[model samples]
Target chain A: MAIAALAGFVGALTGLGGGIIITPALTLLFGVDIRYAIGATLVGVIATSSGAAAAYVREGYTNIRIGLFLEIATTLGAIEGAILATAVPTSALAVIFGTVLLYSAWQTARPGPVSAAAAAPDPLAARLRMNSTYPTPEGPRAYQVQGVGYGFGLMAGAGAISGLLGIGSGAFKVLAMDRAMKLPFKVSTTTSNFMIGVTAAASAGVYLNRGYIDPGLAMPVMLGVLAGSSLGARLLAAARTKVLRALFGLVLVFIAIQMIYSGLKGAL
Target chain B: MSRDGGARRWTDERIEKLVGNLLRAGVLISAAVVLVSGICYLWHAGTGAAEYHFFHGEPSPLNSVSGILASLRTLDCRASIQFGILLLMATPVARVAAAALGFYLQGDRTYVVVSLAVLAILALSLSGYWVR
Candidate 1:
């Protein structure tokens, strides 16, 4: 319970999926069943989303319109992914999901341009009025949105990954909103928070139908993550970004190596 | 320099207006749906055939409604349908509450619409129209 809480706290801070940390810890460290671990992770995802999204919305950083529009794609994709999960082999899913997580971790570690290039406004963004400014330490700043279609497409992919792997995929969603749509980091982060719950909920329904959700496992994880993430969000503003990023990178590398080793051993 | 300043100020006004329009439309629709759904559920509580199993751990068919209104009854269902309902309710409540807060903090009308949209989705989902 303490380890799960700690993992949730770190996950909330870094916008990483608590499952990426918790599932392995539970199964590898605690010797819990993998099915139970997945179920617990789903609950953690819900808890993190509910807690963080509420605060993000209150802070006025979440682009609710964009989040809602993208959810259509994500929700549908999530259902499909859940369906696939039951049909696919567990080992295959684990290896693919781990590879994807590692790639996402690598992408997050590399710095990217914060602002969009000067060019013709994307037609989809222009239609939706997705371009907007956000509050910063300086003042309200302007940002241009681009690639709405592409961003939504990425969200669909991310949603599928989340459903199949029982992971959050906020990193990928953030990348879409931040890089492709050129939203401010705060907006992207908050929007990711808002979208994650709905994405998870969509698959959660399917998981429930398939009997993947175990209430005993889910209860402890949900309660732990909700408590831990609430504390983490309170601490987010005061924490140093560089230090957090370094810690996040280190955790990702460790998890990735562990996953690779586990996959190879299983294969062998 | 003064002309550039004037142009910038004018653009800001236009931008604000556009955002305001979107927000107003979004919030009004979303909130109405949520409020109505919540009211309907409460209204139907008296005579509806819906079962109210508090601590149901697993899903099963219930012919008659069983209302467990107290906190102690929460553990009757295996997965807790009541808890699921509460969880479902949280999304809209949070959305509306957040939008209201956003309005107070940023004075942005868009927040209001965002709140409503969140509620609308919840209401629609709860309606069971899309469940199948």
Candidate 2:
């Protein structure tokens, strides 16, 4: 429970989810089965997303319309991924998971420069009215969204990975919105946070019925992650983003290497 | 168009506040349920050994909603935990349902349709109609 709390804290602070940390920790440190770990992590992802999304939404950092629209793609993809997870070999799943973690580490380590705002409003975005203004230290900064098709495609992939691994897949969501759609980082992260819970919920039921969700393990994890994320949400406004990103990147790289090694050795 | 923008912004703020509170309440209530069950689990089975290296499917008694409730009636700690996790899972579905309603109330026909699609997907998964 304590470890889950710590993972939730970091996850909330970094715009990731507790599952990213909790999955490996459960499998490697606690010697838990990969399937059970995935199930438990899915529950923790829901808890953290719910607890943190509240604050982000009220702060106006989240775009609910964007989140809702993208969810259609994600929910469909998540169900497919969850079903496939049952059929995939554990070693292969572990290797895929490790590769994703490495990608996450790379994503975090090399932050991209802010893209130039589009002069021409995207037809799809304009039609959908996917534009918003976010409050900054200066004032409400207005921004226009672009590349809706690309963003939706990316979200589908994010959802598939999330379902297969029982994670939030926030890194992919952020990339989709921030890079493909030109949403601000704050908007990307908070909206991703808002979307993640729904994505996880779509698959959690399947896991539950499949008998992967162990109550004894899930109880402490859910409560701990919820508590930790609630606190993390409160502190996010005061956090140093660059420092957190750098440190979190290092952690992800380390974990990724270990996971890959374990998977290859058939130890996980 | 500017006037329409102003009105949209106003509605957006209101919806954001409402949704925020809803998410917060869901987490709190579910977490509280989990906390109670967690304490019970630790108290009763804290010292027990649990193996995690291999897959052990959950017992039939804890697999479904009906089964979980039945176990809870017997004061089973594991059932309580499952119940709490169910509530947690419900939180996001509730958020999606609320968003659909909010769009309908705002007369956003397109978004209402979009939100409903998302909700339908979630509903299908939860019902075990499609995922199974």
Q: For model 2, what is the C-alpha lDDT against the true structure?
A: 0.83
Model 2 chain B worst lDDT run, 10 consecutive residues: B1-10
Relative to the true structure, candidate 2 has a C-alpha RMSD (angstroms) of 2.6
Looking at model 1, residue A144 earns an lDDT score of 73
| Each model's DockQ score | 0.07, 0.79
Instruction: State in Å the error of residue B23, model 1.
Output: 19
Give per-residue lDDT, candidate 2, residue B16: 79
Candidate 2 per-residue lDDT over residues A10-45, each given as its tens digit: 778767776878888888889898888988999999
**Model 1 Cα lDDT, one tens digit per residue, A1-268:** 6776786687677666466777777767766666556656876776676666555554456676687668767766766676676577766666765676587668757775643556556887766666666666787677677888899899899888777767677777877886778776567766786677767766665555444555445655665676677677667656665666566667677767767766666630
Clashing pairs in 2: none
Give the winner by lDDT: 2
lDDT of 1 by residue, B1-132 (tens): 665554465443343343334333332343343234434444544555332112233332211012212431643443253344335324533544444444434444554455455445434433332334
Error of 1 at B52 (Å): 28
